[model samples]
Target: MIGRLNHVAIAVPDLDAAIATYRDTLGGEVSAIEPQAEHGVNTVFVTLPNTKIELLGALGENSPIAKFLERNPEGGIHHLCYEVEDILAARDRLLAAGARVLGSGEPRLGAHGKPVLFLHPKDFLGTLVELEQA
Candidate 1:
């Protein structure tokens, strides 16, 4: 089952500029500025006490976030991240229920280095689902 909402990912064309604008206009502060090389994204997590907002930008040729932004022009909420208890078990159960996994079977390092896996939105009524370990 899904757990707490980890963060809402938003794809942007530029990370530094977005960070500056957000901080200047909305008084948002960013933390953990990291590059997810495998996922091809440079991101900063804007923390807001109770919740976090992830700003993502393409780092390379085939950045998934960039593609998402290209398709989703509005560039608002990309995916809802829910922390899970067990990623492998979740994947197995989801597969058994006919849900396809977006990445390979192995879980990948996500925000805070937590293991996470994304289920194909095609299986979740068009909402991209993320299963993460607590």
Candidate 2:
């Protein structure tokens, strides 16, 4: 089952501008940008007391974020990540409940270096949901 809200991911066309908006304008503590080639994204984490905000920029032309930006030039919230005690168990439960899991239906290493799985957006009321191991 899902646990605490892990982080909300936002896709941005410009990574630096997004970082500045969160750090300089909003006065938030932003972490250094980390390139996740495997995930095809360059990420910046804005830490907060309760949760974190993940800023994602495309790493390559074929990156999913790039495609998302093509559809939404202004960029917006891409997904919501929730923590799970056991990712595999959660996947199985969701599968049994007729929820569709994205990709290979296996967990991949996420920005936090935790196993993460993405669920179909339509399955969760038109919002992409990410389940990360707690």
Candidate 3:
């Protein structure tokens, strides 16, 4: 059901600083910041040979990232995304396996412009898992 690792998402309180750290300090090829209003986040992708690193910052006060930042002031890894050949099929399989899918269990447009669904963190060893349609 799951394919290659799509990207690792990190929640950051300061988007600019995180961008600089990855771009200037780490010498990564960073993409322009793209605001994903539907997802309530402003994202910056740091591309690498094997995979990508996603820097996510809250877009509004009510953003989920804002709540995450409230819990973790310093910010940290938010989730791990894996590509899936068929998102709906994957959702059904996860549901049958007793895994809790976040939100409505329907795929939403992700920062990468792909259909994505989030799974409950507790079900995946405390790490939030995101399945993106490949």
Candidate 4:
């Protein structure tokens, strides 16, 4: 049900510093910081050859990323996104297999303006997984 790896999301405490590390130091092409209020994150995508790297910062105190930062302090990989040809179909299959979907079990608009759904971390080897419509 999953396609190519979409992008790896890293939660960072400092968005600007993370962008600079990827852009100036790593010599990666970084996108402008885009605020995703709905997802409670400020995101910057670092373009890579095979896949992209999404740097995420908490949008507000209540943001989930904020809680993640509180746990890690230094920030770390928050999730892994995988592409699906049909997200709803994939969701159904996952549900049938006893996997838990985060949120309302519906796709939300992702940073790329694509439909995306998050799977429960506990269901996937303690790694959060995101499914994006291809």
Total clashes in model 2, counting residue pairs 3 or more apart in sequence or in different chains: 0
lDDT of 4: 0.93
> What tens-digit string does per-residue lDDT give for candidate 3 at 18-83?
999999999999988899887789999999999999999999767888878989888899999999
Q: Per-residue lDDT of 35-120 in model 2, one digit per residue for the tens?
A: 99888999999999999999999997689788789898988999999999999999999999999999999898987889999999
- Per-prediction TM-score to the true structure, in the order listed: 0.85, 0.96, 0.95, 0.94
Cα RMSD for candidate 1?
2.0
Cα-based lDDT at residue 19, candidate 2: 94
Q: Tell me how candidate 1 scores on lDDT.
A: 0.80
* Candidate 4's TM-score: 0.94
Clashes of each: 1, 0, 0, 0
**lDDT, candidate 1, 1-134, per-residue tens:** 87788888888876777788678788988765688887788888888887788888888898887778888765666777888788888888888988898857789887568898887877788877777798
Could you tell which candidate, 2 or 3, scores higher by TM-score?
2
Best by TM-score: 2
